[model samples]
Target: MMKKLENFAIQDFQNDLINWYRNEKRDLPWRKNQDPYKIWVSEVMLQQTRVDTVIPYFNEFTTKFPTIQALANADEEEVLKAWEGLGYYSRVRNLHSAVKEVNECYGGIVPNDPNEISKLKGVGPYTKGAILSIAYNIPEPAVDGNVMRVMSRILSIWDDIAKVKTRNLFEEIIREIISQEYPSDFNQALMELGAIICTPTSPSCLLCPVREHCAAFHEGVQTELPVKSKKKKPVPLQMAAAVLYDENGQLYIHKRPPTGLLANLWEFPNCELKQELNKTHTEQLALFLKEEYDIEAALQPLIGTIQHIFSHRIWNLSIYFGEIKSMESEKLVQVDEETIKQYAFPVSHQKIYKMYKGEI
Candidate 1:
């Protein structure tokens, strides 16, 4: 193990790695400085999003709110608006709470201590360690999926890397290498390699900076290392998404409840369209919607169909765009632009509604 680990310590190897990074590393705004607030925002935005996809969003976000106080002072809608289309909106909600926690509880100052930051809203172990190392240079390592893969292949560990046991093993090793000197830069280097070179599908060993020290690479088994269990198949779900437009070109939209997947977001009027109805469906659906919500009006034709795939299921979103022919005219309620500007809408709807925003 000691012999294998020396590959990381070789002076030429480390310098080569850094030099390669200096030339190839992306010029992301978040990597420009050690600002904790900016780093926190980047980490949250990059949770499940790719780095390329997150770059513009990070720039827009930082430009909007440069400091913790700015973020805390911003309205919830504004925060969610900034986070639209990025998905997994809870991260933004957690960010809002976390920012407020810093302002109200900590005098609007970012905490220097990792454990103290962890206690704040939405901070987990990985996040805490990241903040500690990057923002404050406390020498704590942040072990995420990328770090796990890089570490497992380097040490040739055969254990299930996804399990808690493997995490513990890596944690001990991390503590050993963690240093007050050059802490954040070191961890970032390891992560950058894992992300770009030692990728999951097709690892570019030839481009890897520290491949000489990687046990999996030396033994020609890099592809098979860091095994994970096969994922379960995604289930199919059904939903009816209705788009209502009046003759004036104004569209009717509804606000989602302030919790769950897309909290406090405006959306097209939608309901779970069960699969039980077949050729005898139209009448049953129209009646159900009427009775269920007082819409009670009959639908005419199917306008469009959208397939929205989420982490768990595939939603066959059947959208019906129709005009209410004035049955009682009570179903449609009038809302002003003030209400429209106060909520966030799911990115899917935003994509669809961009065609209609000007008209509305």
Candidate 2:
């Protein structure tokens, strides 16, 4: 067990960290202002996503929905469309829901009170702490993966970062040592340090601003301090997706169910392959069209396969082109290419469309 930093050492650590951050922090769009709405969106978008990838998306999203009211008033489909290609549809969905709640309940203001803010949809501990500390300048702990990695090395904590109890302990440690005078800068500095210097492999300890204060460095075990267990492999799913068009050459698509994985996004009608030993995937898709939508179809040759990996599942999509021989159900809509672009489809199906058009 490592001893806690003494008062003087804590002061030195805070000063060094905040000063380095003020001088070296990346000029991200969200850093331009402390608007809680923008901070909230940026933080939500940044979850499990890279900084560079998020830059253009963040700029475009904020520009489209400039304020909480703007986002809350916008159609859910529109919001989802703006968030297309970002993947993780649930993040935006929850953000949209919470934005509406904020607009209705809080008069378009993001609550500064921890308890009040925590009540909002999808605002977890890290997000709650981040908004409070960074947006409101409250001295709360904002411990994400990066912060946890940095804290583990700095305090020589050997706890498995994968566990929630370990994360709680780190949060407690941050509360104890975080700079009250500059809580926003303090939290951002920690995140920035982990991102640039205290990386997952071959950390740049020599250039680290608080190198002298790092417990793992002093103990010569910086690389081994943050112990994380390996993640389980994503479960594989074999799917057959059909791109069916009517005689008018309008493509058929449907919206996903309201509340589940990939909820409310549009997609080429697809399903998980229950692989009957006797039938081909295309034959199965034809049966699905007949059963689900009551459509008789002339299934054509396989277009191709598209592979998409989610955090918990990998979809191997078998794409097939089909024509609607007859139709009865009103569950699907047929739209021309120009009209189809208005709807938001999952990344996998988007690829399927591009492949159908030979755009790849």
The per-prediction CA RMSD against the true structure, in angstroms, equals 3.4, 1.6
Off by over 4 Å in 1: 1-24, 277-281, 325-343, 351-360
Global CA lDDT of candidate 1, please?
0.75
Model 1, C-alpha of 359: deviation from truth (Å): 12
For model 2, what is the alpha-carbon lDDT of residue 51?
94
Off by over 4 Å in 2: 1-3, 6-8
Clashing residue pairs, backbone N/CA/C < 3 A, model 1: 265-344, 290-296
Tens-digit per-residue lDDT, 243-268, candidate 2: 88878888989999988889899999
Q: Name the 10 consecutive residues with the lowest summed lDDT in model 2.
A: 1-10
Cα lDDT listed for each candidate: 0.75, 0.91
For candidate 1, give the lDDT of residue 164: 81
Candidate 1, 62-106: lDDT as tens digits:
999999999999998788888888888889899999999999999
| Candidate 2, residue 179: how far the Cα is off, in Å | 0.9
